[model samples]
Target chain A: MATLEIRDLHVSVDAENGPREILKGVDLTVKQGETHAIMGPNGSGKSTLAYSLAGHPKYTVTGGSVLLDGEDVLEMSVDERAKAGVFLAMQYPVEVPGVSVSNFLRTAATAVRGEAPKLRLWVKEVKEAMAALQMDPAFAERNVNEGFSGGEKKRHEILQLELLKPKIAILDETDSGLDVDALRIVSEGINRVRSTGEVGTLLVTHYTRILRYIQPDYVHVFAGGRIVESGGAELADKLENEGYEAYVKGGASE
Target chain B: MAEQNTTGSTTAGSIEVGTAGAGAQLAGPGTGRTTVHQPIDARVAVKPSFDVNDFPVPTGREEDWRFTPLHRLGGLHDGTAAAGERGEDKVGFTLPDGVTAETVGRDDARLGKAGTPVDRVAAQAFSGFEQALVVTVPKDAVLTEPVRIDVRGEGGVRFAHVVIDVKPFAEAVVVLNHEGTGTRAANVELLVGDGAKLTFVSVQDWDRDAVHAAQHSALVGRDASYKSVVVTFGGDLVRLHPRVSYAGPGGEAELFGLYFADAGQHLEHRLVIDHDTPHCRSNVAYKGALQGQDAHAVWVGDVLIRAAAVGTDTYELNRNLVLTDGARVDSIPNLEIETGEIVGAGHASATGRFDDEQLFYLQARGIPADEARRLVVRGFFAELLQQIGVAEVQDQLMEKIDAELEAAV
Candidate 1:
């Protein structure tokens, strides 16, 4: 039902020296219900694409056309983009002191859903989602990410993904700091949402270990600030065996 | 009164410059010491006195007065403004059973027992008031209701003094609510008796054109507990100095304050906790938020631990949240410890602007900019607000904070 198209997207970030381009003429299209795994090495602009689509002020879209269902996504404000159903699971979610998780979730849901959810049903919904994520009941009363462990932070991001239920959810390195058990738990949460078949996922990672669990429908090799190769899920297995060193060297020569 | 006068003069003693660890040992020099020397540190250099002449008018240069704007004080510091007669409704009190409230002459023996005037304004307030209101809770009595004193100021120069005395083994809560328009200077003395427990709250909700300065001095008695909460929301210029000293061993004090400043308003809080006795503890935490141009806030916390005060546990923390471009915050926390034998002593101060990343995180979840700002600001003050035990006061303060946020937007 929803489609995201990124055409020749050029993004720049203010580096210490000057404005440096990160995503150089990158293009991609993802439709609802599709799982696209963007595989890359460090500093290969995989995360840049995710943040740009979410409208982070840090990355300036120099030349790009990001359209969501024929609407210009690039012209929308960050919150507007979110209200239009785009979510970014940040690699490092900032700590918000004094804001309890329950309060934050309710506020966010009220903003996104355009009406405050019914109290009884909303509480029950949050309780059930947290239980599925194996989060403690007391976690709802805690300040957001105040003193959470790395695994706990990742789980919290997935909890938001499930609750917010955005049309396009970009998971930015969700498996980077997760342990084996945590990885399995988080992947299970993602697959549960994917089973709804109403959300498109852009799973950006530097490893193929997570692909083993989620089974991406499309795998894109990102190098030199753009996608250099695209294929089916078999490409993820090839990268698992051969590694990104091949594309890193080949993209540099281009 | 004679003993107080002698101590006041001897403690006013001499100023010692460039002396090592002089500030930590200068709390009470009249306890049998002949050659008393003042600490070079301006915070504790000036001794307390009941006479206004002993302290000179602050020209906004002294460390204690530097953060304060003297021009906006409406002549409370220099004794230039004429005192207008206060109406009968100026000061009113609501006392529960077993509690007494009366107006006593300044010559009463109980007037200056808790503390002497620390600065020129406090001394002026001490020497200027015609009568002092004294509220006392009887010995061994526990009150179910709070004692409320409402001081409503009419537009004029005014001087006021109040004393809250809790008898031995008594437990009570006191709320001092200040409102209306006035250029006023006040001194409040809190005396917690042996084995007594007291919680005192002072709310400064004045009019927009008011200028007010007050010193709150608390004496924690033997084995007693004292808690003071100062909330400042309205007023063009407001400065509060809350000081605590232990009267005996095993005393405990907790001082908490919250303030929000709007455009062209100056709110300052200065705190001093003197650990002059052994086995006493103190904690100070103050938080403030500023919005709009020229909205300034100052918080200075000074904790002195003398050598005689062994087994002392003290810590002071201050945090400021600047919510706009031109708002400013000055937070200074100073701890001077003369003994290494104490339990623990530390201080911390931090002033930070509204975080953009926090806003982004909230907005990414679909919260609008203004609502996100409100949430973050509310959360910033939530912890300190909960410490205020009175629910009605807390709700009112939250509403005021929301109004401040809305006005800023």
Candidate 2:
């Protein structure tokens, strides 16, 4: 089982004005097969936590100690962190022209699995995964994210999640822009991966609607660059009945 | 007799496979532009001269020779260079029964009838050639095999002339492969007769020390179709000029070029397509990649549509991928339309380093940065490689490109 420990994490971004701190002092811990929901209003540092954890170059780890099973994650490069079993299903998947989806997936599989997947078997596996995600088989031949719709991008991210099989997956707004049918298909893909019991799911989103599809074990109310309150699934229900107002008022959080 | 050269042993697929639309995404001429850059200069005066003395040696100041290094020309422009001790040029042909090759004197009526020497070196070639090789395809004859001519140059300076004449209603493909070059200047003419189709491939894979300059001209007959593929690799300095003019209406021309330049190599191609006839069509696309310090690739495309050429359609695009820090590329595409009545006319030119986001997206998936880089380059050339109709040539080009990537990327 893998364990990720983020202690007092502080992050900043190189904005046009200067280095602006986004994550002041945040702490969270996630273990294998557990679902952690980080919910917050806009500009509350929720996506910042996701990107910083995944080692995005734009986000700087000013002061933090992130350990993945006692190994230092902060010291690793973005790709090294991925090799160390960290996956980030980005909110905006970058478009790579001339690189077909099938080729990219196969290359990533070869790099991560340490060898090329048997062509016959890999084709079947990818076809099945794409079917589960409701992605058209023709999509495999198109360039990655080139001219793709918003919902298609999200579905592709989930497709990678099902194939890469990382120890920890930080899904940044995977539910955004997805219609109800697409959301159901994407949620099913995440649930299938979660059913494997080898991945730690950190679902970062603004709404509790996705939490209903993929039930979260723990809910953390994130605000002011910190996880101010944490509770069981009841906290998400509370946030749903009310809103971030009770927590943002400064009493329910501390 | 077709004397085969030892350097011609490399199979058509062994050296380079290019033609890909990897640069299509980067082909835009940038935002909100109304005025075109430059017009095709018909008055530049590269007309073929019968006498070598009629053309003066260029000092690199002429419009056509501005990009060329006159010193690297090995005196082919002046008449100081001499032929090597190597006896003759080689030919590796798969000519069928319907095709014929004849070594004729310069006085032959067909010689210089299709094209004229545009520059001093071309005129020098026209004047100094001992004999011209004229290959002909019979009327209504569709050859199944490509007529292959391999010219192996020995480091000395040699002037030559060649012609491939396709008879009316005939179809053929001709490949002229140049290798083991010293200093060589030649003029090539293709006469595509009425209702005929011809595909011409000229591959210049000279030695690292060789210098080569050549002029290629084609005359398209009524309702005739012509296609040319120019692939350049190797050589210290190589410059090629390709010119096209239509003799009658309903003619079509397609020109595709691919080149890769390494350190200290200077490769330049200047193309002119004169739409002198009405209802003619032309398309030009050239892509190149440059690596190593001081490696340069230059491409200039000029298309002229005269007032008499109504209902003409033309488009040209050139793209360059600068793989390393020191490499450079200059691409200029010009179109001149004398008549307003035309189907479409436009051109695009782009030169840029590899896309960083493409690299990042690939690396994010665990493919190493270096491998990711190689894939990008391969994709950049993949579209052009697919355009090569011959499979063996494609394989050969793929292997050569792979070998280059192994050492560099």
Candidate 3:
């Protein structure tokens, strides 16, 4: 089992004036087999936290530590973090032209697995995973996310999550653009990985609909660059009905 | 920065420039249009003259010679670089069934039937060559395999000429492979008979210090089709000029090129297609990647549609990917349309660095920066590699591309 710990994390991004702090003194702990739901309104630094833990170069870790099983993730490069079993399913997955989906996935798997997988077995694995997510096998030959629809992009993220089999995955708004059916399918994919009981998941979303399919062990209400409230699953139901009005007002600048 | 990926579409006049507009200038040439120092004058087209003195030496200021370093021509231009000193041309041919390969003297009637020398280098090649080789396919015959011509330079300065002729209704593919280069200047001619189809492939895989200059011309007959595939990978300096003209209506021509210019290598490809007849079509696509300091690539595509040409459709595209610093590309697309009653004409040229977002995306997937860099560059060239129909050629090109990328680090 693996554990990811973020201690007093402070992240900043370069703006017109200077480095503007986005994550201020945020602390979080995620253990393998545990689901942590970080729910927040727009511009509350929830995505920032996801990117920071994933070692995005744009998000500078000023005064914090991102540890994956006691190894300093901040000092590691982006790919290093991924090899260390930390995966980030970006809210906006990048489009890479000229790179076929099969090539990209195999390359990534080779890096993570330390050797190239057998071609026949690998092709079978991809076809099965894509079929599970309702993706056509043709997606393997197309360029990576080149002309995929939003729902296709979401499903592709889940496809990677299933294939990569990381120790922990941070899904940033995986349910944002998915329709009801796609959401259910993507949620099923997530639940399949969750049921494996060897991976931790941090689902960052604005709605509680996806939580119904993939239940979180703990829910953290994020506001003002920090988690202001935490509870066992019940907190999500409270936010679904009461909304973030009380938390936003409570954490507003005085 | 490379040209932003754009779907092919028919546009009105020629000369289309593409821009990434993503603000990621990876230090490529700023001028996105074709880079020809001057327009090719009307006098560039003429009958082949087998006299060295018929063509004057270039001052490197002419439109055709502007991008070429004249001092590096290995003496094929100014009469200073004599023949049979630096390299000797060793020619061999492997012909398929029902094809003929012949070595004829300069007076052979079949010589120079496809094209004439337009510049001093071509004229010098025509006059100075000790012997010329001609390959022909019989009428109403179709070949299953391609005819292979291996031109290997043993040593010394060599002047050479070659001709490929396909009779009426005959279809054939010809591959001209150059290796073990020296200082060499040569001229190649293609004659496609009525209702014939021909695919001519010229590969220049020269030595690191070799210098080569060649002019290629094709004459398309009525209802004939011509396809030219030019692949250049290794050379200190290599310049190839490919041109085409029509003899009858309903003819078609397609020109495709693939090049990889490494450190201190200069690869220049100049093409001209003259549509003097009606109902002719032409399409040109050339892709190149340059790496290392002082690695440069130049592409000049010129298409002319005469008033007599009524139903003409033509489009030219040149794309360059600059992989490392100190590498530059000059792309110039020129179209001179004398008639407005044509079907369509267009050209596109783009040169840029690798997309930063592409690299980041790959790296985020746990691919190391070096490996990711190699993958991105390979991806940039993958599309063109698929166009090479020969399995062996494609595999060799892939290995060469990988080796070049490995040295980039």
Q: Which candidate is the best by TM-score?
A: 1
Top-DockQ candidate index: 1
TM-score for chain A, prediction 1: 0.97
In angstroms, how far off is B84's CA in candidate 1? Answer: 5.7
Name model 3 segments beyond 4 Å from true. Answer: A207-209, A221-225, A231-254, B1-50, B83-86
The full ranking of all candidates by TM-score, starting with the best, is: 1, 3, 2
lDDT of 2 by residue, B1-409 (tens): 1111123111111111122111111110222333211223454654445578888778888888888888888878767764443235666676888899988887676766555666888788777788888999999999887888887876666778898999999999888989896788888989899999998988888888888888888989999999988989889999998888887899999999989899989999989887768999998888888999999898988777777778988887787889888887877776666677788776777778888767766666677789889888877776676666767666766677777778778
Checking candidate 1 for backbone clashes, the offending pairs are none
Report the lDDT tens digits of candidate 1 across residue range A138-252.
Answer: 9999888889999899999999999999999999999999999999999999999999999999999999999889999999999989999999999998998999888888555
Cα RMSD, model 1: 6.2
After the best TM-score superposition of candidate 3, give how far the Cα of residue B42 lies from its true spot, in angstroms: 5.3
User: What is the C-alpha lDDT profile of model 3 across B58-114, one tens digit per residue?
Assistant: 888776788898888877889977634645677788899999999888777677666
Local lDDT at A213 for model 2 = 93
> lDDT for each of the candidates?
0.84, 0.81, 0.83
lDDT (Cα) of model 2 = 0.81
The CA-based lDDT of model 1 is what? 0.84
